[model samples]
Target: MFERGTPGADRIDALRGWVGDGGGLLMVGGYLSFTGFEGKAAYRNTALHEVLPVELLPEDDRVELPAGGRASAVGTGHPALGGVTGEWPPLLGYNRVRPRPGAEVLATLGGDPLVAVAGYGAGRSAVFTSDCSPHWAPAAFCEQWDGYARVFGGLVEWLSQ
Candidate 1:
């Protein structure tokens, strides 16, 4: 997670270099991830952007779905969505992102990309555009969603492959 601007140029370069050398990277979203709460994350202009599957918006990209939004697998055979089925728990919010060329969108929320995957050099990378813990994901998604482990575990397994 490239949360706030703690990573300097050196750290960003090191991370990119490491991932280019076959490291698997998984970026989890949060108030400090992606464009962040009010577009403060600012990852788009950094070296870490090289591995992201979506183009980060220049301004605040958060969408508050107070009524909640439904997310579902885009494709049935995607390994990252393996064993994930049924209606997902409603999400309270998420980052708005556009999938990059050659990137595969594995899941979506209200028609927007929710989970995306792509290849960067010799490694693989994935992005989950919603917070993994609170505010966006909601407590129900964290504790009661039956497919939670299956979805995330599949993402990790896919990256290892």
Candidate 2:
């Protein structure tokens, strides 16, 4: 289960139901992801928080990262990162995340966990700090790095597995 464009209590409830019903979710980051800027995500009541391996702090100036400036080591042991090899191209930006207890920290940025994975009942979830597009990750949009495809595709496969 994936939801985009809106974040609120209704959507959060919907996501919770989906996960509880055995559906996997990949909540992409954006103005609508998690508790977006200005607390627009407040209505969501953080319901999906339980399903995530990380906690989203109130969006502050902290979310900003220079475009194409840094890269983190991929989790080679994890299937979601298997095909993504080599020095990663820079990612323009990513969401700021606080890891939850008992969560698997897969990748990090400057001492912060950038990617995380967690299991919830019969399903699971993965949190990618950056937007899954060229704008936020120009390398992904240009295909200059095969990492984007492998990371996202591998995630879908892992969720199903």
Clashes of each: 0, 5
Residue 125 Cα positional deviation in candidate 2, in Å, after optimal superposition: 0.8
lDDT of 1 by residue, 78-97 (tens): 88875787788999988888
TM-score for each prediction? 0.90, 0.80
29-116: candidate 2 lDDT, tens digit per residue: 6556666667675423567877887877765413666645465655668875646655667666666678889877777765666667
For candidate 2, list the clashing residue pairs, or say none: 8-44, 9-43, 9-44, 67-92, 95-129
Instruction: Return the lDDT, model 2, position 133.
Output: 73
True lDDT of residue 124, candidate 1: 88
* CA displacement after TM-score superposition, residue 13 of candidate 1 (Å): 1.4
Give the runs in model 2 whose Cα sits over 4 Å from its true position: 1-11, 139-142
Candidate 1 Cα errors over 4 Å, as ranges: 1-9
